[model samples]
Target: MEKRFNKIVTLFAGLGLLVSCVSENKIEETFGVKKLVDNCVEKTILTINGLTDADSLPRNILQGQAEWNKVGIHDWTSGFWPGILWYAYEASGDSTILSNARKFTEPLYGVLDVPVDNHDLGFMLNCSFGNGYRLTKDSAYHDFLLVAADSLATLFNPKVGTILSWPAMGEKMGWPHNTIIDNMINLELLFWASKNGGSHDLYDMAVRHAETCMNTLVRPDYTIYHVAVFDTINGHFIKGVTHQGYSDNSMWTRGQGWGIYGYTMVYRETGNEKFLDLAEKLADKFIERLPEDGIPYWDFDCPSIPNAPKDASAAAVAASAMLELSTFMKSEELTTKYKDAAVSLLTRLSSDDYSSKDKNKAMLMHSTGHYPNGSEIDASIIYADYYYIEALTRLKKINEGRRL
Candidate 1:
């Protein structure tokens, strides 16, 4: 009897060991996330401080060979650096990171006064002041963002029932009333503003904009166009064109990702069933087109498929969106599908092909910013790093029984 008991005990102990190994392997898979985020933060501080010390306005560090190339404050990409700093502070609780965040954030005060011509005010003010308000709860940040929302509302036209994306370039060039799929990402700021005592009209405008895009921009299969032009005078449909896509009818990977993220946010803000439906459709299409590794080429329609340059930024954005999307799902199957896809993308991005450890003065690599313009191609983009860290933070929160 004693011998039999010993054998059973040994078998149970071995099973326990197997369970522990499985748990540890899962941890091992994600262990690089913290180390990667920390390394990226350290390199970002050095690069931003060095640039600001040299009397620079502080913007995106696109690429660094011997020296870094940065955009100006007026450039659309300017707001992401401060956002990166805020994420660093949230992850580390380091006061020095907060100081740098403030320094970089103040430069965006001028953006509120600049005339609204594009769908980037949310990208500008919300990234800097939006995160600032959330972290610090400072009234100044709130006031600035409220005014920025008002500035954005200036471009909304009741006739067109959507906010204008491209400025009135010229009659001969067409596109007097153009709204791109990218504009969907900007509505979060409008929703936040209205809820926080800004304007009800702003909320209405956002809903109308989403409706207009849903009507024209999204195809039946959930593939999206880069740009859609309409008759400004009467809200008549003009034509759809490709500004930064493979063709006029192809899916621009980043743009489709934006659609998913944007519609997910709209559903969150409004509890509208239609917005949720749209988000789920876009999410399904995006998941269908993802490469086996989950990262995507700049455009899904690119002929080079296996050899195409991957855009880590799009994956980062999509993963973040999927994590949020899982919370709104009703079915266990869909929740698992979206959440697992997010984890897979995050895992691949943290690998050597994408993750960097201060190697080239950037965090996430292999991000293609604008394939059509041949600008910032195959480099580390600041926004890519921002969203990657944001997704990691979201996952950490989920593990700890919290929300981001």
Candidate 2:
């Protein structure tokens, strides 16, 4: 009887040891991964600060004939930098940052009214005008948004049931037949148009564009192609091709993020079941591929890119999108799963490794702007900064409930 009792005690002790080991492993996986990402964010912020001067303008802007050299030019990319700055300001309530952002955006008002032949009008005007309206509630911002919407509406093609990418350039590419995954961002203008301008046509066009993208651009597995060529004359799918990714069938991480977020936005605007379903499917695929660190590579399918670096920007964007999708999910299991994943990613970004306490760069690390083209790989991109702050903001709101 004594021997038997001793054997049972030993068995219970071993089981408890195993459970403790597993628990420690899980905690390390969560916190350890976040530490690396946080370091990246710190470095990025430091770098951005180094690039700027006392006036809060980038030192590069002081150079002659650079894109940032001009004060009032309609720079499509400027909005992202200021947007991130605004986000940082809002997060910390730092008055100096807010003042600098206003200074940066005030000069660009001239070009916001000018019609440009770019697909990034939403990235440009939406960040500036939308933020302006949200902050000041000024009618001028609303007016600018309307003008942008008008320009964007002209890009819509009824045949393809989507927006024409950009003006046909040197090549024989059909204007109305061209669509890209990035057009997801452009759809926000349509949503604003419908809400502010009372244009049902814009909303209908946005919905159809999303549907066309779903039918033509997205794969059965939820991975996305960068661009799809359609028949301008007859609304027929022509061919799917990759513009910036490794190959036509390759899964670009940022493109997947765009699909995830875009579909979620579509669901929000229209309450469409199909959009929500697609968003969930894409989220599933994304979460499955995350590394132990929670950050993703620039392209999931191209795991063998020689010397290719990880893209922190893509991870940040996907994290923000996942947070948005979490709100719409009915399953608490899924909500907790996605919300935790997003929080993990954001926590990593906010850690000392990813973020700089000195505020030199104003970004978090691991941004790859372009790898195949050998441009801006593993560098700090303005949009990456913006999306990272957006992810942080969303995470804060989620944690604080509706108070934020």
Candidate 3:
């Protein structure tokens, strides 16, 4: 659901948000919160129980495939499956879910046992063990997350002021120092560790990486480049390009979502107004480009319009970011604006067009994963389901006057 080319003004004029044409929107309605979350999660468990275990993690399933395309512990997405389980346990308090989550989580220790090869340790460990520690307060999980943070820190290039997203591939791709916008989300693991027991250098490294991304990756209008190439020689800017987006110039919807979520979280952890400002700007740009449905297409600038694959995964990511962002706004109007936007997104995601419902064992569908590679086109991706459940849980808590 991207704003089609050249129709931006007309679309805004003819159509208003679900909240209204202007002013704050009401958020107290009973939108079947418990039923929706429970059913989606129940379907998730039923669908995944048979496919996933400590041995393999489900990534995505294409149409006509009877089973999900599974991966081993080395897969970057492995932690999301367990992270989803931890969120499920937090929401339902189901002991079975808890047991299954632990079953899937313990095997990931191999990540810390090896030298970090990629910038996804945060995704691999934090999503799984980080949430586990937050929910269960398991001392082992806490200790593991601290090690994960240190491992992730080893990837930081002090010269570039950003973590190397793909260390092994950088040499082959001729990008000596490359940082993807998705790297922003991983900073949370470092932030958490610095406050817990790790050195404050972890926190400093995260902020530096974010600052590098803010300067190099974010475009003038705040639409993000999927990847930014930095000069390794002097740690100077080289050029902005894309590997997963439509082109070197187009706005990747998911990249923008990562920036939004990243900076909001940075602000939350650091109490920095500059980060909050950047988060607000990123959110505004995202909202400006969103189509009527609030979900975004794979790329806002993709030549294809109605035919471009919709990334429900991007919507889930932004929805969760906005919910937390709304809490930090000083202006009542802006806070209402974000929370209302989040509600609109969640409502649409719950609808038949997006929600897998009885059709599949996943929570949501129609996610565009690596469209340029023609991989997992319009499939149910694991990260989509992970962030979708996380957003739903956050909404449920917010509605009940509980802390997110």
Q: What TM-score, to 2 decimals, does candidate 3 have?
A: 0.91
lDDT of 3 by residue, 146-212 (tens): 8889888888999999999998767788888889999999999999999999999999999999988
Query: Which has the higher TM-score value, candidate number 1 or candidate number 3?
Result: 3
Top-TM-score candidate index: 3
How much does candidate 2 score in TM-score?
0.80
Q: Write down the TM-score for model 1.
A: 0.89
Q: What's model 3's lDDT at 216?
A: 92
Top lDDT model: 3
Error of 2 at 8 (Å): 51
* Residues forming the 10-long window of minimal summed lDDT in candidate 2: 59-68
User: Cα deviation of 182 in candidate 1 (Å)?
Assistant: 1.3
Provide the global lDDT of candidate 2 against the true structure: 0.71
Better of 1 and 3 by lDDT: 3
- lDDT per residue for candidate 1 within 1-404, as digits (tens), equals 99999999999999999988786567556555566667767876776666653214433335555345676666777777788888888888889889888888887897756567777898877887899899999999998888888888888878878888878542545787888887888898999999998989889999999998898889877899888888877888787788888899999998998999999999898899999999989989988998877789989999988898889999999988988998888998988888888988888898888877656666688888888888777787878887888888777666555776
Q: Which stretches of candidate 1 lie over 4 Å from their true place?
A: 1-32, 53-67, 168-172
| Overall lDDT per candidate, in order of appearance | 0.82, 0.71, 0.87
Query: Local error of candidate 3 at 44, Å?
Result: 3.0
